[model samples]
Target: MAELQEFIDDRPDAREVRKALAVKLVYQGYKYEEIQTILDVSLGSITSWKQAYEEDGISGLRLNHKGKKSYLTAQQREEVLSWLQTKECWELGELEYKLAFEYDVTYESKRSYYDLFDAAGISWKKTTSLNPKADEDAVAAKKKEIETLLARHRQEIEEGKLRVLLLDECHLMWGDLSGYVWGKTDQEIAVRVVNIRDKQTYYGAVDYLEGSLLLKAYNAGNSENTIDYLRYLLDQSPQSKITSFFGDGASYHRSHLVQNFLGEVNQDLSQEEWKIHCVRFAPNCPSQNPIEDIWLQAKTWVRRFCALIPSFSHLKWMFEWFIRHTTFDFATLQMYGAFSEIKY
Candidate 1:
């Protein structure tokens, strides 16, 4: 029944689509009032549609047309399809205004407006903001460079001379927990979150060669936190001939303090055989970092039991549990497409 409602909500075939949807709801034990409210049809219409469906199956419903024909003609529909093909962003209210003023057509409701968009094979969805600074060609070149460097590092790892680690920071707040879960289609499933600005920022690093994760929670990310993390890593693996760590182009990663900590010559910028090396990932490119995958898995696990997580301390405990219990595979992480996509 939920699936049927989704189908009905998504397309604008005809008025009969609503009747068909009503019939399904009726069969699913929905009261006429509920059906009328959901489908935006009168009780009389709902009764007639149900009777028509019961008397003659789908054929009876098809015979009943509730109103005049759609305002969008065949040519206009073709125009809409072409516009959709252009992949331009549109607001529903803007489209509604365009329909009313430009085409002299008005939909009965927002539902009907969306139905027309669905008919045009368009959908409303959540979107991520794209970085305007990102360049495809530069990203491709950087990806190739990273892959070549990784291949060389892999050879060093085999010789027990180098260890490669990917690092990133995650803001762990009460609102961070959200994902699809089993719930009634007509209602929303709410996750509890605190109103206070209380959160923890975790600086996390994963050794792709050993599949071991190092994590530290902080109030915020800065040069101090980044340098502190690098110092911790240096102490953890002091004997390694070379420890190369990859991170995003955050200011802290390139700060003078961090550079000095890594033993780099800040003035001349010459390469030195330091025990630890800091490598910055390409700007606006996160797919290259596998630590993101680890955080995703951990956050997913935390969201699964969102009801049980009541406090910040409990959230930290859950993070600890996930990290200790989960056995992240090294070979799988190394072969992740973020690395393979660059290989020619």
Candidate 2:
């Protein structure tokens, strides 16, 4: 409207002018059609301009509101956003501790003091694909199919009154980078790292639980290592009379070496003759295997206390430690409460 233009023109740097116009147009009794006729602007423009003035005050009265912050001070917004991006967080109340430790001053702060940090509009996130590399629905269906087959086997054995060992393998890569919460994001990202010292070295494990175990890593996953891992498990739990083994459709699990090893192990114990029945999971359905959850559980522990791990060996050691302690705690044994058990 001519009135709005006149107001902006007359009031040089008059921030309050925008609030006055908004109150009159929207809050006070004024017909938008009549107001538009008087101002010579469209309803959309009026809406846009009114919102603009409310946000920027007098500066918002401008035709556009760009490169300006709302509620958040520039430095405060930057600091808070940057902190959120890292693995560190400073409490609003204890911010005085940081002040005292660094600047030797204890400044008081209110809980709402962080409101400006939130109003900076930094928390919005863009949607990302659950499986950026593959179809999620297909993957889920495959996992379900594998689970169903295993469930059928378990049901049959249970009805017939039998105890069977579910033998399998897991590999530990020395340079496994695992996943991380890095890069420019409001969401977490998973990045793989190569093991420089060793590539194909693996670990095999066989477990007989109601569910399945899965070995996860980058492309460095293979079968020879899986069998070797199984051998180790056999050595430790020699008394375990497992009857069968199940694995996902990875090339390693189906390889000649793995089959030969299992055959040899079976032949050695001919008297017991535990059935070497094997079932392969639907291809690429790692989620169906409970072992994947095991790895995720391990990684979550690393994120809780430590930020950057120095090397792959450290990662392995810490992971083993976390797993041992986590398994011991009753709180952790309960589904989804595993991480809460870490007293340290």
Candidate 3:
């Protein structure tokens, strides 16, 4: 110990050698906390040094062994972290390519590349689906239109004379329902599953004002099913309230048949009688509909126990159960800030 201290004091620049000397002291029965005072090093550093010596003797304590130099400095890596958070999605290889071209730092191996990502606290994740083709100008126009309609219906909404309905569709499959679950590291989560390719489609609507629900299952969603759904809603609704249908730009909603039905219904009704109207949401914008959030909640609720669900019939039952059970709090849904007012 005396000789090691003398050597360290005589050669203060030999950091790696000093680290090895500290580990040797630990091997000679010195506690890490005790060694921290003598070596003028943190207990954490002392512990790591001891672990390295245990794993690979003195070689593990060697510095300048993080392999090839990183292209990015510490500060630059923090900048990269900030930049990554701002992106909607990215691939690791693409990011690596960008780093190479932008910072002139190329990694020699996949391990080193991943090490940098780990240090930056970035993880590979499933990308969220968003419509890249949505027109920004059209979205702005739709937003303004929605605002105008809300203002126009403000008095009706306050008086509860107008019913605001949001409509959408969803699909349920027989396999893994929605999200990831805990499992063995390398082994996939397995289940005794059947009908992996089969799916059931459903058309659903919610009256945000009255919290009423309408759900129907179908083989697929198309113009015919949409028309049938509208007929069902019109038949089920009260004969005195003005019902407004809000939906996305699915062809069925705007088809000549639907438009003709709506026009006929409006023509037959007096100004004070039951009536229907339609408003198309912006192109490629599902967020404009509050019912989309309800679908997500219903799926998440039922799919959490998907592995235990016995059959397709049972799954369908569970799906309907969650949909029926889900609380339709208009204020909470409106708070999502998709639309400033629910009048339209």
Is 1 or 2 the stronger prediction by lDDT?
A: 1
Show how many residue pairs clash in every candidate, following the order shown.
0, 12, 0
Instruction: Give all TM-scores, in the order shown.
Output: 0.64, 0.43, 0.65
Better of 1 and 3 by TM-score: 3
Residue lDDT tens for model 3, 252-319: 77888877777777786675454766677887877777788787777787667866777878888998
Among these predicted structures, which one has the highest TM-score?
3
Q: Order the candidates by lDDT, highest first.
A: 1, 3, 2
Candidate 2: clashing residue pairs, number: 12
Candidate 3's TM-score reads: 0.65
Candidate 1 lDDT over residue span 78-168, tens digit each: 7765765565577765665556556655554457667767877778888876777777777777667767776766556555556677789
- C-alpha lDDT of residue 128 in model 1: 70
Candidate 2 at 57: error in angstroms? 14
lDDT of 2 at 222: 65
Which regions in candidate 1 have their CA more than 4 angstroms from the true location? 1-67, 71-79, 93-121, 135-138, 178-192, 210-212, 264-273, 327-344
**Cα-based lDDT for every prediction:** 0.69, 0.47, 0.67
Q: Supply the global lDDT for candidate 2.
A: 0.47
Error of 2 at 7 (Å): 12
